[model samples]
Target: MYPLNLPPAQILQLSSQLLCSGLALLLVGLAAAYGLEKQLNVPTLVLAHSLTLIGPSVLKIGYVLRLVAQQRLKDETCAHAIA
Candidate 1:
């Protein structure tokens, strides 16, 4: 668990790290798509485009999952507070 006293600078740094990691994953997925198209004898152009299309959806799903987890945590906190 993260310390509750985390400073704004530390938060910003963590945000930057997450953004960079996400970008790296996106690039790796693209590269994998390219390789799959070439090695699997599929249509490279179409698969690359599909990768672009699917990448955002994958990221959004991750965002949704994070939101759900956060929401659940918040609810638990509130429940504890009330009790």
Candidate 2:
């Protein structure tokens, strides 16, 4: 499902990175949003909200990429073994 035509290992690597980044973003966003709620700062709140929205999307994409990569790797191994 990913757009990139990369090897399964490469996709897996990229997905791992994305998962880390997404988790970090999600935690930071949640903390920022909670802590900044009392400040009533528009820009900061907007940034926090943006991060909150983007984090889950990135996580989902990363998860899907991981699944696809793993599936491809499994298929490749099975094909090679059967040959």
| TM-score to native of every candidate shown | 0.53, 0.89
Point out the worst 10-residue segment of candidate 2 by lDDT: 31-40
Note the Cα lDDT for every prediction shown: 0.58, 0.90
- The sequence of per-residue lDDT tens digits that candidate 2 reaches over residues 8-70 is 999999999999999989988988888777785889888997889899989998999999999
Q: Summing lDDT over every window of 10 consecutive residues in candidate 1, give the lowest-scoring window.
A: 2-11
17-75 per-residue lDDT for model 1 (tens digits): 55455565577667767655556544655656566666666566555445545555676
Q: Candidate 1: deviation at residue 2, Å?
A: 25
The TM-score obtained by model 2 is 0.89
Steric overlap count per candidate: 0, 0
RMSD to truth, every model: 8.2, 1.7
